[model samples]
Target chain A: MESVGLVPVLCVSVVLFVTGVAGVLTRKNALIVFMSVELMLNAVNLSFVAFARQNGEADGMIYAVFVMAVAAAEAAVGLAMVILLFRNRVTVKLDDLDIMKG
Target chain B: MPTFNDLWLASPALLLFFGAMAIMLGEAIVRPASKTGFWALALGTLAGSAALTVVIFLGPSADAFGGMLRVDQFGLFAQLVCTLAALLTVLFSDDYLRALNLRVGEYYSLVLFGVCGMGLMCLANDLMMVFVALEVMSISMYVLCALKRGDPRSVEAGFKYFILGAFSSGLMLYGISFLYGATGTTSLPGIGGFFMGQHQGTQATLVAIGGALLIVGFGFKVASVPFHMWAPDVYQGAPISVTSLMSAGVKAASFAAFARFVYGVIGTHSAGFVGVLWWMAAATMVVGNLGALAQRDLKRMLAYSSIAHAGYLLMALVAASTGNASNNPALASLLFYLLAYTFMNAGAFIVLAAFTRDGQDYTDIDSLAGLGKRHPWLAAGLSLCLLSMAGIPPTMGFVGKFYLFSAAIQSGQVPLAMIGALSAAAGVYYYLRPMVWMYMKEGHTEARVAPVAFTALAICGFALLAFGLVPGPMLGLAQTSLQSLIPYTIPTH
Candidate 1:
């Protein structure tokens, strides 16, 4: 792993991403889904910071800062929305949103 | 040193940012329900920013912020369109929101914020800037969609929109990562350089993959086919005004920005871009038109129609890539279609708002039955709108379609042009269906307000006819706007 350079690190990020995607996809609970989304974002953040270090450019770090800001905002809105959803459906089931079915 | 060139570069954004602050202040001073002041300030603010954009346009095009944003004719035209749409939205929003008991002070403020984000997005020459500006726009719009909190549909629309929108943003950002991986920079010109400098086959392949991912990201935003699943439900459930905003304002802004990204950077083979977009555009046209056929709900029908129009614009994008952009005039066609679409789509929604009198919105096609007898002027206005949407002659939609088809034929994409015209003919059925209900079917449909901002309605109607019959000037305007965008040379690092 020490011999592995930035490319392998990018691969690790990709692995984390796939795991997160799996979590979001296989889970039924909204909480789990939200956590998976965070996981995905964190993976991206790690990859970005790695790319920043590897490329020797500051844009990746700037982008990481943006990712954090956006992640924080997304969390706030997502949680608020989750609470509202729970209030409406009385259950946190993702499958319950059938009001829009054709 | 902060040069004057940089100051001039930032003027449009500076104008809108300060405009938003001014509106908030005016709201503070005038207080709630001060319709006149809120609207005047809103109009004054957008008009000011638009004027700033025009001023910026007259000067030479250049990049700013270490090559993150670029101010040019393309950005200027999009900013103008978005600001104008926001202004018109504010013009009638007071009455509409007042009627619905949703006229919060923040609505105008959010609208301005959304417009500002949209304007910034139009000028975003960098990847990270695009994401930030897009979020600002999306978050505000999510709030706006659910602003009518009392309505279950409104809340539903907002939640659905938020979830999908957030997901799409992530996907887009993820795509940008792949792009950055390939290019080593997020700037458009930088990416262009990565492509131009790299003679390596694998590097070109990497860029293509990134390009494809980026297309997926944009596909979700623009509600293209396969990415359009959310549009009908969301458009139907959201507020009428929000629907209007999404259909016209958001569509135009996103398309302009997307065009800049694809055309200005990502210098792929014309055929490759055209082929991918061709399949996407054709699919969108078919699916959207087909979906609209089965929808009984007016909002849902228009939603699908919105998807179909997105397809038409995508066709223009494809045409732009192909030889047609030069030979057949695809850019002008696309711009003209966007303008005509703004009028007809928004006019129809205004009529829908007029009918949202007795607690719930009038969603069903049956709801508009005998509207002609009940509300003659509203019916007439809506009829004109529908006809234009159907691409019938002597209406703006027809002229727009003529430009589109002529351009397509000129570009040697005869099949695409044919499909567009045929599907548009199918459009006549749904567009005219409401008219048939209004004229032939028997029912009472009274608008609560007798006056109902008939002036704007009249303006919309007249604009369609005036532009349709005498499209020369508007065509020229569109051509000039397109020309201003033509000199965009992707900078090589």
Candidate 2:
């Protein structure tokens, strides 16, 4: 059985993280931005697992699990906020959230 | 398997967690007509937790939960500050909630849960603990900000905060993973020990990048410049009570974890991030203070003021990098200033909470017009709070600023100290503008003060004055708290 090298896994993780960041910055739809955040978290999980394997320890893997759980909790609240925003303002686009601008 | 000793060590947070759960259960089962019982329970829980934190503060330092948390005087001090902030916030929340017609038992439970997370954050000894605790605190805050669901502005604030908050947490998590790979451990002291050993090439690069990312993540949480765009809008939109707690309690807890991480993980090798922090502190102060000058809304102005205070706190971290660990005036000043900030900042918001009409907070600067003539004592309390914020003499803010700047000068951060002083001086204009309206302007505002909230404000005003006049005992305590971090604080060359 062949295993991936640490450098390659890290590179892929970085690329995925960059993409997620771009999505968060460029995407206007609140739902997409949130999904992008999840993507970033998953990218982190991949790196954590890879690092744990390279280090021959379970700490990073444990951290990955924790990140997943926390992300789910965040999603639950984030989606509720989105729904709440829609209920009040009838829009989910980030641009529409301009009620309290300076 | 955890021992009884571990439970005892962590009981302050555990108590809040259980209290929050009890509130939820009791609210559901009893469905009481009045929320006073629930409010009293929450306040009692916070007071009890604060008392326990003080007892723990008097005890010796130790680690609990297998070194997941350090039970030290430093963390205990932060926990005490957080509990106090939460207590005052709850004391004032009932009236504000009633004024706005927000009837949900969850408000008390969420506040308790949030404070529980803050206590855990102060004591967190591991990177993983910091991340988890941060989310726990932030999620509660997200809901609280939008508790006024009928208001579009409140919902927008909550959504914006959620998106940005979640984004920053992801960035922080990625940084933590890099750090874990670099040091092969999630423990703060373990990372410091790794740096103490030989490290070169790829490992060094990993640490540098990881540390930078971590700072950026913290920058957003504390609402410093470039990352602070969300602050004014969210602060303006959220319910005033939530804003007060978020500004005080969240900032204190986040700064606690940030200070511990900087002193513990990046100890002695402050060169890695000190330069970055220097610029951040400078920009945050200048931008925050200047930004406040243009604001017509009082809430927005205070939000910017809070950002400027974050800058001052970051200056202390910069100084910490230059001096010996145990004797570092920077760390001591940071602790004292956080306590002072929690009081004055929250006290200011309590006064703003008094301006409710038709289920909305009237936070325009004009809303304060003629307050001095109409409500003399309320205006006096607010004036004291504002003076303290402006660094006026015989107030806690003055004493705190003096310590912070002197510590910076002592660490040879003279230029940064000057920038802080100049910006704080500029800040005085906005702080005084409200007073001018309260006393000199002729517009009318029928503000009503709640007894409990007024008492809390009085306590804040008295503490600001008393501590400003006799700061010796408090300064001594702040300095002694640093002793517990000796093992983690490596002496600089």
The number of the candidate with the highest TM-score is 2
DockQ of 2: 0.90
Clash list (residue pairs), candidate 2: none
True contacts kept of 1: 0.14
lDDT of 1 by residue, B1-493 (tens): 6578776777766776776677777667767655556666767777887788878877778777776778777677777777767765666776787777665676777788888888888888888899888888888788888777666667667777777777677667776777786678888777766655534564566567667867887888899988898898789888888888888888888888788776666524434755888889898988888788887899999999999999888888777767533333787788788888888877787788887764567778988988888788889989998999888899999999888877777777788877877887787788888898999999876664334356667777898999999999988877777775642344465
Chain A TM-score of each candidate structure, as shown: 0.89, 0.96
Candidate achieving the largest DockQ: 2
Worst 10 residues of 1 chain B by lDDT: B484-493
Every candidate's CA RMSD: 2.5, 1.7
> Which parts of model 1 have CA positions greater than 4 angstroms off?
A1-4, A22-26, B1-9, B22-37, B197-202, B267-273, B324-328, B449-452, B487-491
lDDT of 2 by residue, B1-493 (tens): 9999899899999999999999999899998878988999999999989988888888889999998999899998988888988998898999988988887898999999999999999999998999999999999999998888999989888888989999999899999999999888888888777766668899988888888888989999999887999899889899998899899999999999999888776756757588888899999999999999999999999999999999999999888877666588998899999999988987898899999856878999999999999998889988999999999999999999999999999989999999999999999999999999999999778898888999999899889999999999999999999888754533221
Q: Single out the weakest 10-residue window by summed lDDT for candidate 2 chain B.
A: B484-493
